[model samples]
Target: MQRPNYPSGKDLLSADAVSRFDLDDIMERAERHLREEEMEKAGHALPEPPAPRRRPKVIATLFDQRSTRTRLGFQAAAARLGHQSIDAYDTDRNRIGQTTGESIEDHIHTVELYSDLLVVRSHMEDLPYRVGRLSYLPVINAGNGADEHPSQALVDIFAIRQMRGPIETLGIALSSDTRARFAISFVKMLKLSPPKRFTLCCLPDAPLNPAMREAMTVLANLGTAIGIVHDIRQTLDHDVLSIQMQDMSKFAHAALGNEAVDKEKESEPFTLTARKILDARSDTLILNPLPRFSELDTSCDSLPNAGYFRQVQLSVPMRMAILERMLLGIPWTGQADSFPPSSGG
Candidate 1:
């Protein structure tokens, strides 16, 4: 059989190229292949698939920002696929941001000689585009200053797909850290159908971040409804996926306010309790981006439909497919051809 002719990283330079990178491309085609043949084999189930194990080159992680899951997840994904990850933290370390302030272009050009890809996390929204203009290697915006975190969105979708059946009209409630809010925001924006509706349930002080707002723009274009409410009850009315984002800064208030706890005392509601979900509907699925706080009640764990922990477990396989594609350079575009025509398009 002929091997898949995947699009090179250079193909992403055009906005029209999105059809080439759409998640459906991964879900229908790449994911099937990875699950069937290419997933990493170890103590898990299958070893690495028959496809080439090692990446054609190295990836320089130029993280100008901080992250635990994004950074570590990428590193873990790269290693699982037999790729090398070079951590370039400071200009003192990589000399890109310091020492005469070498242009990002120059730094990218310099690194391209040794690396096959660049994973960048910047504070500026347009920085990825500017750097992409200069780099010859594939560029992944790890978290481009809240404008977008496509990879996280992809993983979140992957988790949802595993836990629930379909998402065309799926609704999600975000009760997470500001960082994770961007991922939910992007999903609302870029989704072809977008979520029917989404709710923002955070303390008044911990509102959605700037990038989250950008994602909301995408949802707005789709005419998808969005509500920014101080409470979760407003959102539980829908077929909900609760994304509990844990930020240490917000943990202090976890014990205060809300109906689950007595207002006279310092206690918060059990956001993910079975009782809470049962009040809404039994099928309500729980989701968390990981590193959780006390907001999610432990009682939900015994319920058959409880899915947050399963959401975390699903990340391994979803990431396995992503690593196979990025490192092996799988062309996710095949779905446009592989599946029969659908009326939705």
Candidate 2:
């Protein structure tokens, strides 16, 4: 069968799609938007006003999983861009996945007709890929099942840049589940602006995740000094440390009643606390994709190093930048025609 002729607009399906040039452009746009917002907040009139669009664009969000940040972030971004948004999929109102429902093809075709862009978040890893193949409308993979949350990674990088400084000069550490979608995307995206030193603080005895291992190898090849340590303390000396709960698969399986929750406290060794930072007298800028669990202790909230809340705030402009760029039909220059098997997630 012949492949459908996709539109010139790009789909941001993976961090690997973004190039250093793309990153620079997006970051510049985001910084400009943030400055404009700050100026407006200070009651300063702009020297040049935003040109109104001939017709307001519509952004359709097809999220099969629960979300608080990604959904609102895009909606806010669309509104800021003088566009509209619609929740394209609602299990309560839509029948796309029901026995009596329309097929995904029919649903996507209908959505593409109504919207200019499609933002997808699903527990199914392949949903965004399937949608990208099925529809000509540009698709943004909000989050896929333990696969890649590329947009969130962009937000994270933006936060780090804004809070710390240039990406290439910093020593960065990630304390997370090796299989985490965000972690995978984070490490992959780092290749565009390789850090001075990159560290992975994860389980000691467990073998590295294939996807993560591949991403780290790319960074290593790029001359990033990569280290793997069992304890979070080993990473405390780094300029920035991004952290999340470990072994999400175990928690997910437990939640689904597939198996008993492991009584073993694996996270203790990896958890970050204010006490540790204070005792070490470290100045590491701490970041977390929120809805944080026990992995990030609340005691760290008052510390100057805690940047997660600010990280959340920075996501708005970054999201706006993404929508703005994609709407212009600019494709990511670095995207491969086909991703390698090891980079699937």
Candidate 3:
């Protein structure tokens, strides 16, 4: 199979921001990167990584909201790729001469003048979209409001594909809060690499029903089964389970007003007990994106199948692939066609 076609204008603002190339394009590259590291660790000599044909002076990571993993991961990725990552932010919401009441378009233009690529995280819903529109440089969205976190989705799919042989037909459970930005972004990526069955089991008040019901049609066209449920136990049969922290918007006011809200037991609905996991298929993979809150219990962490830490470990290479794809160039193993044909009704 030919290497995937990357677009001429190299900006990735969302999961489908560029063309939906084979999802294997991302995963296979990450797999090779990981293997190269493991080989080097075992005292095997390897060829040096190629320097970029056109390297950037700095990758500006602009954050309108705070982040730890996204910020630090990109920096580590940049360093590995032979580039510097700069943390760029505006505390007063004033860039492009915000003191002069400058427009966002002009601000983006000004931003492009200084940086090679813009990795942005915004409190606003579509700030990265507008920025990518105006700036000639690459605009890689770190996260955008409640809608998407494209890089997180990239790292996530990479982790899952590595753990399992092929992402094609795995039954994946999206448990806990279905409305979290991480879950939404991940599901969007799944459109390109549809699993055999996707089960979204959330709380009683989850708003994922209407939109996800529609996505089921699209996923079905790509040969994946889909189901939505409020009962978390229904996910016990899945090959992979990701438990997300519940949404806390409604309870924020109570906590701010000094009203104690007891939410620990409320989290029991989605917690993955050892019994639930052990009784499933022996190879079942447990996934979580952490700062876990109460959704993922501590007991699950030491389980051999727990993939969250390895998931975080893979983000370095995942982000490296993301940045290098858009900015510099990285090598791929060329295994897109080798993936098994997706199996499901």
Candidate 4:
């Protein structure tokens, strides 16, 4: 974990880039960190955690927008991984680039001179890519317009794989605004290891944004049984929850058969209550890219099938894994293992 050695001109600005990195190796290191803490509580001899060296790395963050989970999460993760997180913006939302009328390319270049990596959350979706195009340093897209939030997608996937099983064995369904950036990013990451089943739970003829639709096509080509459900009732159907129920098979395909959907529903576009979920395959996991107004009722918070809330708890560890991979290079694996050579190269 000395000043690490890695390929020059690499960056992490999109779901495709995140998919290429050794996510599995990164995650293993996080689990190692947690295990060390558990062992300490048991009054047992603590075995050496994965990386022994403790060289510190610096991460520069540039946010044109405000965020609670992502901004604080990156900073916390940097400390956990023995790194630094420096904000490129001030408390008043003042950015050097904005104050000086500098181009994003130049802004990225300036930060690369000081930090090991850059985390950008911009109002424009393409801005992260623009920065990556100019800077050789690794760039993480914290929240990029409405196009995607790749890191959030990473945390959700990691949590799901842990509770259920592998990606190939889960019948995953995402609800709420399918066209939102969170939804788009989450679905794209899921496509990296297309699951046994995926359903977009939305209203009738809900507009499928081109970005999301393309991702669905990719999963379909990869052999995942993808479905689009308009009604809350259809979500619990046998076909959608058929292939992957290894963890909840005892409930079988009875997700919502016994219960009735709320006759008096919320004034939201989509709603999933505990009753509907319980009557369906008890194993079908419900996910929502949050900031929810009413799309997801509060009633489901206590249910066993909810995975969205865990994403918040996992934001730090997932971001910590990214810092360790990009900076310390602790769990070094070949780029080809997860990261393919960039097409532009």
How many clashing pairs per prediction, in order?
A: 9, 0, 0, 9
**TM-scores for candidates 1 onward, in order:** 0.67, 0.92, 0.81, 0.76
**Where is the poorest 10-residue window by lDDT in model 1?**
336-345
Task: Provide the lowest-lDDT 10-residue window in model 3.
Answer: 331-340
Model 2: residues >4 Å from true position, as ranges? 1-4, 250-266, 339-345
The residue pairs found clashing in candidate 3 are none
RMSD of each: 9.7, 3.4, 8.2, 9.6
For residues 2-39, write the lDDT of model 4, one tens digit per residue: 33343443566666664434566656766665565468
Count: clashes, candidate 4 = 9
Of models 1 and 2, which has the larger lDDT?
Answer: 2
Return the lDDT, model 4, position 146.
Answer: 62
Clashing pairs in 1: 40-47, 41-46, 41-47, 41-48, 146-211, 176-245, 189-218, 189-219, 255-267
Candidate 3, position 266, lDDT: 45
Top lDDT prediction, candidate number: 2
Model 1 residue 75 distance off true place after TM-score fit, in angstroms: 2.4
lDDT of 3 by residue, 29-77 (tens): 6777787778878998767766574755688877776667888899998
Model 3, C-alpha of 261: deviation from truth (Å): 12
Look at candidate 2 and give me any clashing residue pairs.
Answer: none
Per-residue lDDT of model 2, residues 37-116, tens digit only: 99999999977889998999999999877778889999999999899999999866899758899988899989988999
Q: In angstroms, how far off is 293's CA in candidate 1?
A: 4.4
Error of 1 at 248 (Å): 10
